[model samples]
Target: MSKGKEMEGEDEIEDLCRNDSKHGSKKRLVARVGGSSSGEPQDADYSVVASLSDELALILARVPRSEYWKFTFVNKRFFSLLKSGELYKIRKEIGVKECSVFMLASGETSWWAFDRQFRSCKKLPILPSDVCFQTGDKESVCAGTHLIVSGKEFEGVVIWRYEFAANKWFKGPNMINPRCLFASATCGTCAFVAGGIGMETNWKVLNSAEKYNPETKSWEPLPGMHRKRKLCSGFCMDNKFYVIGGTNEEGKGLTCAEVFDEKKNDWDLIPNMLKDSPVSTSQSPPLVAVVNNELYSLEASSNELKVYLKGSNSWKNLGPVPVKADVARGWGVAFKSLGDELLVIGASSNSYAGHGMTICTCFPKPQADELHWRSLDKGCTNQMSHFILNCSVMGA
Candidate 1:
């Protein structure tokens, strides 16, 4: 072959390699560069490799949050994906969420959490030294991904915020009005506490209300309710806060209820909650919660779960809680909505016999007859003797 013809062929081969590289065709570029298809370069195709990593990130985001920490050790890329908020955004978009139950055991300073996916209980970090459980109206509410626990202590009213991402608790801003047994609810990133007994001399019932903003780590006062109530049940639904079934300043059970609208910063009086149920004056405050954007309440006397129908402005009896024969009805009981299940934690009647705790989960059926409940743990009944401060459902 002539030198000029050979040089021209080499130029053509070089031009082909440049074109393939520009078009992102690395496979053909490798074959031509090595001058033989049999022994092509063994290096990875970086563009395809990157695409695989992107796909893996999307898959990992859908994994249960309980397993996210373990996935961080898989690789540097995995760690980055888990640490970034992108995973959570994707999970939200896909509606992939898991709710875990967080409980503050009576008389115990440490908080314990139950993971639904694992069906296991793990202790969170110890509470701050300044924080102690006192005999007052203690409350726990899930605000976004954090848990805010507020209660009366010797030091006065204190609030602590726990972040699941950090696996730790930090002291939050103190409440402007230190009261216990108040109605509390969480809406969006903020939490609201309203109408509780004051910490002063007689522990008088109060009509005051306040809100906490986690982003600013500050508490802002809200318009006080029309009635001074203590031990009222508070819950958030559709961005509205409802306070119901608590004692008034005269220490008498109140049948009427009120709703607070955040945007308007006003309270609207609703029909009496007890008009239909006719709760006895001696009965304790009803346990109330919002599940699936609907309100539910468990009367302490009958232990029957009722769903509030706003359209009708009335309550529908779901049925009596599946209280064990051993568990004394309505003794130190708590009701919370966790994910798709309703969880009840209380003490068995045999609690005095050294039983530790009684925990159960209820699955609601479309038909009343199909509704059922299952006991998750019945090992301890003794813990029932002590007060159950609060129960919260959080996304892990």
Candidate 2:
């Protein structure tokens, strides 16, 4: 091509690039490609540089779990992506599954959350006035992102649900019967409450069971267990619900365990846990939790942590509860599974008012013989007045 024609073509391209800015084009050519009249390259559209989904996933994965609730307010797309399963998948792939520990104070109707990343505790919003009266020995369970609390009010059985997304508490459907000290566990999408003492007639022990469907905001009765149970412990594993160690109708400690198969709509009595472990049936039902799909129980009598092995149908002692000598007694202690660690929180059993509160974390490894428990919070202030009633771990 002739030199003049080549120069003319370059000038024309530069003119188009310069006009793009004045015309408010979403994209523009780089200065290196065609000199801009402004002497600076136009900003490239970030969406064109990378897909929106990929960019959003990257950003959301790095966001701290505690700050996640605020990010949802960015916009509708941000809110949807933050709550979607796709973002969770990205978090899993990036190893960013952050678990926060939620605890309810003993006498007060207040809730407290400890953020593992920040190593700090923050008071959560107070429960609604209707449900604020619920304190002491209430049955609470976490279903998906909602915290469901079931307790007895003056009128009858009251159910309250708190959603992290909304940071608000709302009333849920009332139970079929008013009861307390019930066995509660969440499986899949529903929360199941099994045997507990009824509010009517001398607080009669109940064998009745019911499942709460959050989507429908209703409760449906399930097949009652073979025997009435009170102070029973419930856990969901293998897509089934298991109720462990509780007192019978006659106020006798129960040794037999029962498993509810949802598909079969039947409860099968499993081997007795008392026979394998030193879990005392005299006390309230032992603390049971599922971590990494493995069942663990904290036997208050022995103050030892045991893991359930399905093949042997028994619990093997993982180790003793990791805490100071005084707190190791396991009195009023609560255990929660946070990611790969077990969080233990309670006051020292030896002290009536001086011990404050003890918080410990233990990481279990199959091959490691020494499962060291790290004390995250040694009570500096006396927490004897407040009880760490229940705890739950939520991943954001």
lDDT for 189 in candidate 1 is 54
Each prediction's total of clashing residue pairs, residues at least 3 apart in sequence or on different chains, is: 9, 0
lDDT of 2 by residue, 68-119 (tens): 6665554444455555444444444444556766777556557876687326
- Candidate 2: count of backbone clashes, pairs at least 3 residues apart or interchain: 0
Candidate 1 local distance difference test against the native:
0.66
Report, for every candidate in turn, its global Cα lDDT versus the true structure.
0.66, 0.66
Error of 2 at 350 (Å): 9.3
TM-score of 2: 0.72
User: Which tens-of-lDDT digit does each residue in 1-396 have in candidate 1?
Assistant: 799987875675455445545756535333222233443333333333232233234445557777776665545444544454445544544445778777766676677776763266667898664435544556787765678887656766777788766578887677788778788877655788899888763788898899887656678999989899987778888889888878887777788899899789999888676677654445555677676787777666665778777777887888776543223334356787776677776654344552446667776543364357777753333343334556788763
User: Candidate 2's C-alpha lDDT?
Assistant: 0.66
Q: Model 1 off-target regions past 4 Å?
A: 1-59, 75-96, 107-109, 130-137, 200-202, 278-283, 324-331, 348-356, 365-370, 377-387
